[model samples]
Target: MAEYLKLGVKNEPAMSQASLGFVGRSVAVAVVEDISHNLDPNLFTALKDAALSTNPDESKQAVKAALAHGTHPEDIADFYIPALARDMGDLWCADQLSFAGVTIGVSRLQAMLRALGPNWASDNATTNENASILLIVPQDVYHTLGAIVLSSQLRRKGFSVKLFLGGKPEDIANHITRTKTDAVFISSSAGETLEKLRQIIEVIRGSSGATCPIVIGGSILDVQEIHDVTALTGADYATKLPDEALKLCGLQETEKKKISARNGT
Candidate 1:
């Protein structure tokens, strides 16, 4: 067996055992590391110039060339493309990147996993044959990128999701009444919104008789906080990916045991 692995790029070596798979991971890492380390200072400058240039076709050509010459197409499509589109305020381009078969890179994979919540909920809905999921975001929390990504992931995973983005408390109550959803997901990008979220949970509980589980997630709910909030709301907190969240809500003993073991309990 070859002890030394030459990743697809010219001079990079495989950094981890997991990268040895014959798929794109090794090549992807090599390309990203190489470009990050050796690309000239002018590359990003050129890309920005192209993104901001007056001639649309020429600007796109320039950006494409920059991506093609220095970075793997997968990396560009997955990580760089979305980040660039976001930084540039071009959501249309970001949507294009999602559909462009961009293999999610390691750094961005965490966000992608976070987005998988709705999918897991949807799967649970179908399997039970009597349940559905309502994905809820607060009125003030405008960051729906995670939700949008998660919605798509859930759809791909064969779950139905009704996304109520930035809804008022009344709107959420009305949605729950109408849909009789199996689960509700509340996501916040900031910790400052925790009080507001707590209020919303209280309102939902008071009005809905605590019928459905309200799952909270995002950067705000780290490990300890997930448990605490779940206790506070009398709902559940999804500390892991969406699938894990769904399993927790459904109370699947085997899945719960597996998660416990993974968590070293």
Candidate 2:
């Protein structure tokens, strides 16, 4: 893969594994490994460029070319596309791209995933029908690429996910109540910030009481921040990765057990 890409680089094993979920002996874990190990660096570059392209057709061609080698669509959606989004974030932080450009890049990634057809999410979903999840993308925040990607991941894992965005606290709470969702998710960057997220949690809890689980995730959710989020906001689980958030909510099962999940306490 690197030979075609001409980039003598590989993400560390730990970093690669974290993007999917904690690697395990499961078939799902193995599939993630297959895609992670197979990404061509050149393909990755082209994807990044495509995502940031101003012309939608140009972006399509870039994604089309990457898959020309018979690359799995899931590999692009689940692996490379996400990596490109993060790369766009990195470039934004370095002043290489503006916020608008980054947003467009993420939109492009979503467009590519949407183009892959209906089978992609179902192919990845577990048959268990484990949990009903409310994936919230709060108002006043623009970047939803991670949430978009995470929604697909959760759907793939058998959660009936409803994505919420730009709604009032009452509306959000009402939707959760109306749908009887089992889990509520809030990313740090989803709304104004973590502090605002704390308020969202408070409002949801106030409206719903203690029945539904509130889970928090995002790039900002390191171990300490996770503890802080739960402590400060009355949230039940916090994770740095979207898939790990599922584990924290105890929505999926595997051969080994993790101790951190509170399962909505």
Candidate 1 lDDT over residue span 1-265, tens digit each = 1111111123344334332221221111101112343334465445444443333344456545765676543343334433433433332223322211222222233332233233432434343334456766677554455565555444444455777777888987776666666667776553334567778888777767788777876545543476666666555565536676677667344444655666899
Off by over 4 Å in 2: 1-38, 93-95, 117-130, 190-194, 222-224, 254-265
Candidate 1 lDDT at 265 equals: 98
| Candidate 2: pairs in clash | 124-156, 125-156
lDDT (10s digit) by residue, model 2, range 128-238: 444677777666544466666667767665567777755568888787666666678875442135567778888888777778788877644533466777887788987
Pairs in clash, predicted candidate 1 = 117-242, 119-154
Compared with the true structure, the alpha-carbon lDDT of candidate 1 equals 0.49
Per-residue lDDT value at 138 in model 1: 70
Question: Relative to the true structure, how large is the alpha-carbon lDDT of every model?
Answer: 0.49, 0.61
What is candidate 1's TM-score against the reference?
0.50
Listed in order, each prediction's TM-score against the native is 0.50, 0.71
